[model samples]
Target: MSNDQLAAVFNAGIREFDRLTPQVWGPAGQSLITQLRLRPGDAVLDVCSGAGASALPAAAAVGPTGLVHAVDVADDLLEMGRLVASDRALHNVDFVRADATEWEPPSTVPAAGYDALACSYGIFFLPDTDQSVNRLVRLLRPGGRIGVTVWRRGALTDFARAYADVLARHLTGPAPSRTDASPLSRFDTAAALTDWLTGFGAHSVEVTELSNLLPATPQLAWDLILGGAMRAPLLGLDDDTVESIRRDFLSLLTERDVETLDATTLVGTAVVTG
Candidate 1:
C-alpha cells in the first residue's frame, strides 16, 4: 500500500488504542522491556507509542527524574495518550505528534541523550528500517540500547495464516500484496533481524520469540483486526470482500474455537557503540 493508504488505515486504529492497547501490545513487548534494563533517571524514547502502551510503563520505570518522549504520526492517538498521562498524573511523559520515520531528536533530548529506544510492533510500517535504526542510534547516548518487536513467521501464528487465507478468499484481484513483504519484513527472522541491527552499528544484538493466546472468538478476532492496527488493510477492502473474509475466518474455527486465537510476538534488541 502507498504511504497515504497505510496512514489512513493506521489512523482508523488510533481511535481504538485505549481499548486495544493491552491486547495489541502485551507479550509483544516483554522481550523489549527485558532488554532495556531501565535505570532510575534514564531518558527513554518510545517511537510509535500509540496511546502510551509502552510509554506509561516506561514512565513509571524511569520515575520522577526520568523523562519519556512518546512520538507517533497519529494526532488523535497522541491526544488519547495525553489524556492517559494526565489521568495517571504522570508529569514525566511527553506525547509528540510526529512521523517517527522522519523525526529527529530534539536538542534537549540530544544533549541529555537517551539510554534506550523502544519501538514495539511499529517498525513494520517504517519502510526505511535501516534509517530508522540509525536515527534511534543518533538519539541515544553512548552505549544506549534499542528494542523492537515484529511479527514472527506466519506458520508460528495461526491467526496470521487465517488472515492470509481470509485475504486470499476475499480479494479476487491479483492477490493483494503480502503485508509482510515490505522492506522491513526482511527482519522477521532472528538471523535477518540480528544482521540488520548489527549493520546499524549495534555492538550486541539478541532476538527472542514470544507467543500468547489471543482472546478466542470470531468477534474477538474481528475486533482485533477491525479495532486495532490490523484494521488498516481490512478498511481498504470493499464491504462484500470484508464479509467474505469474515466468513472465511469463521469457517476456520471449531466449537468455541473462535473464543481464542494463537499468536506469537518476535522481539529484537541491540546496544549501540563505536
Candidate 2:
C-alpha cells in the first residue's frame, strides 16, 4: 500500500488501536525503553510513536528535565497521543505528524541529537528499510542507543493462518498474501535482527525475546485484526464479505482450540559508535 493509503487505514482504526495498545504495543514499548537504558534528562526520538505507546513511557522515564519527540504519519494517532500526554500531564513529549521513513526532525529538537531512538513494530512498513535505519543512526549522537521490536516467527501465526483460511473461502478474488513477505519479517529472528543492526553500523547489537500471552476469545481476535495491522487487507471489501470472513475466522479459531494469543516480540538494541 502507498503511504497515504496506510495512513488512512490506521486513522480509521485508531479507536481499536487504542483499545489494543495496552495489550499488544504497550509492553513492547516498555521493553524497548528498558533495553535502551534511557535515563533522566535523556532526549528520545520515538519513531512510529502510535498512540503514545512508547512515547508516553519514554516521557515519564526521562522525567521533567528531558524531552521526547514522537513522530507518526497518521495525524489522528498523533492527536490521540497528545491527549494521552495531556491526561498524564507529561509536558515533555511532543507528538509530531510525519512519515517515519522520510521525516527529518524539526530545528526545535535537540541540536546535539537524540540520546536514544525507539521504534516498536513500525519498521516493516517503510519502503526503504535500510535507508530508514541509516537515517535513524545519523539522528543519534555518538554512543547513542537504538531499540526496535518486531513480531517473532511464531507470534500470532496460528491466528493469522486461521484468518487467512476463512478469508480464502469467502473472497471470490485472489486470496490476500500472508504477512511472511512483509519487510518486518526480515528481522523475525534474533540472528537476522542482530546482523541487520550491525550492518547499519550499530555496535554491540543485542536481541532479546519478550513473550506476551493474553487470554483470547474469537471476538477479541477479530477486533485485533480489524483494528491493527490487518486493517489494510480488509479495505475495499464489501461489508458482507468482511463479515463472512470474520464469522468463518472465529469458527476456525474455536475449532482449533486456541486458548491464548502469543504475541512474542523480538527486541533488538545497539549503540552508534560514531
Candidate 3:
C-alpha cells in the first residue's frame, strides 16, 4: 500500500488499540519491558506508539527522572497518547506526531543516544521496514537495545486471517500481495522474519514466538474491528459484501468460542552496533 493508504489505515486503526488495550497490551507491554530491562532514568523511544500502550509502562519503569518519546504518524493517536500521559501525570513521556520511517531525531536524542528503543507491533506497518529499522536503531545509544514485534503467521491469527480472507473474496481485481500491499503481512514465516531481522544488522538477535488470548468471542472480536481499526477499509465495502464476510467469518470461528484467540507474534530483540 502507498504511504497515504497506510496512513489512512493507521488513522482508522488507532482506536482499536484503546478498545482492546486491557487484554492485548498487558502482556505485550510487560514482555517488551522485561526484554528491554528498562532501568530507572533510562531514555527510551517508542516508535509508532499507538495510544501510549508501551509509553505508559516505559514511563513507570523509567520513573519521573527518565524520558519516553512516543512517536507516530497519526496525530489523533498521538493526542490519545498525550491524554494518557496527562491522566497519569507522567512527566517523563513526550509524544511526537511523525512518521517513523522518516523521523529525524531532535537535539535531545543525539546520534546513537537513547538508552533503548521500542516499536511494539509498529514496525510491520512501515512501507520500508529496513529503513525504518535503521532509523530506530539510530536513536539508540551504543550497546542500547531495540525491540520489535510482528504477526507470526496468518493461520495462527484466526481473527486477522478471517478478516483478510473476507475482504479478499470481494475485491474483483487481483488481491494485493502481502509485500506489495502490506509488508507487515509478508513476514509470516519464521525463516523470513529471521532473515529480515538479521539483515538489519541486529546483533545478539533473539526471536521468540508469543501467543495470547483475545478474551472475547468472535462476534465481539469483529465488533472491536468494526468500532476501531478496520473502520475505513470496512466503510468502503458494500453492505452485502460486508455481511457476507461477517457471516463467513462467524461460521469459521464458531468453534473457537468466547476465548482469547490464539494470536501469535514473533518478537525480535537485538543490540545496536556501530
Candidate 4:
C-alpha cells in the first residue's frame, strides 16, 4: 500500500494505535533513542513518527537547546503528537505532517544538517527503502547518528499468518511475507541489517535486538490489526465484516496456541559518513 493509504488507515484508528504504544511502540522507540545517544544540543529528525513515540523521547534526550522535527503523513497522528508535546511542556519537538520520503531540513536547522536521524518501525513503509534512507542519511552531518527499528526475523510470524489466513477468506491476493522481493526481506536480520547500513553512507554500525514479547490478548490482537500496517487489508470492509474477521482472527490465534506476540525488533544505529 502507498503512504497515503497508510495515513488514511492510521488516521481512522488513532485510538487503537495509541493503545498499543506502551506494549509495542514505546519500548522500541525508547531503545532507539538510547542507542543513538543524542546529545543535549543535537538537531534530530524522526520520520514516520506516529504520535511522536521516538520523537518525544528524542526531544527529551536533546533537551531545550536541541530541536526535533517529527514528520509523518497522518495529520491526526501528528496532532496527537502535538498534544503529547504540549502536555509534557516539550517545546523543542515539532510534529509536521509531510511525506517523510521527501522531507527536507527546516530553516532553523544548522547548515551542516541534522546531528542525528531516527525512524522507528517506519523504513518498511517507504517505497524505496534503501534509496529513501540513503537520502535521509545524507541529510546528516558527518559522523552523525542514524537509527532505525525493524521487526526481527520471525517477529509476528504467527500473528501475521493467522491474519493473512483470515484475510484470504475475505479477499483475493497472495499474503505478503518476507519474500525475496519484499523490502523488509532485505534487512530483517542483524547481519543483513548491518550490511545494509554499511552499504549506505554509514559506518560503525551497531545492531541491538530489543526482545519484546507481549501476551496475545484479544484486545492487543485487534488493536494491532487496526493500528499498524496490518490495518491496510481491512480498508474497504464494513463494520460487520471487520467484526467477523476479528472474531475469526482471535479464534485462530487461540487454536494455534500463539500465546505470545513476538514483537522482537532490531534497533540498528550507525554513524553517517556524510
Best by lDDT: 4
Per-residue lDDT of 1-274 in model 4, one digit per residue for the tens? 7778988989988999999999999999999999999999999999999898899999999999999999999999999999999999999999999888899898999999999999999998898887898889888989898999999999998999899898888777875444567788788999999999999868899999999889998999889888987888788889999889899999999999999999999999999888
Per-model lDDT: 0.72, 0.85, 0.71, 0.91
* Candidate 2 lDDT, 1-274, residue by residue in tens: 6778878888988878887887888999988888888999999999988888889999999999989999888889999999989999999999987887766767756787889989988888777888887888799888999899999878888887887777677766655554667776678899889988888778989899998887777656876887776777788888888888788887888899887888899999999886
Model 1 residue 4 distance off true place after TM-score fit, in angstroms: 4.0
Rank the candidate models, highest lDDT first: 4, 2, 1, 3
In terms of lDDT, model 3 sits at: 0.71
Give the alpha carbon lDDT tens digit for every residue of 1-274 in model 3: 4555555765766656566677665467667777778899888988878777778889999998888888877777778888988998998898887777776667766455888888887776676677768766776788888887676676235566555665677666643333335676555566776677667666777777777645557545765565444544665777887787778767656654525565566776777774
After superposition, candidate 1 runs with Cα above 4 Å error: 1-3, 14-17, 110-112, 155-157, 175-180, 236-244, 253-260
Clashes of each: 5, 0, 6, 0
Model 4 residue 42 CA deviation in Å: 0.4
* lDDT (10s digit) by residue, model 1, range 1-274: 4456655766676645455566667556545776677787888999977777778788888889888889887767778889978999999999997778776777656484788999887876676667766776787888988888886665225565567666766665544443555764688778888887888788779888777667666656766666555565577567887787777777775522455665566788888883
| RMSD of candidate 4 to true structure, Å | 1.2
TM-score of 4: 0.97
Which candidate gets the maximum TM-score versus the true structure? Answer: 4
TM-score of each: 0.84, 0.94, 0.82, 0.97
Q: What is the model-wide C-alpha lDDT for candidate 1?
A: 0.72
Give the per-residue Cα lDDT of candidate 4 at 77: 93
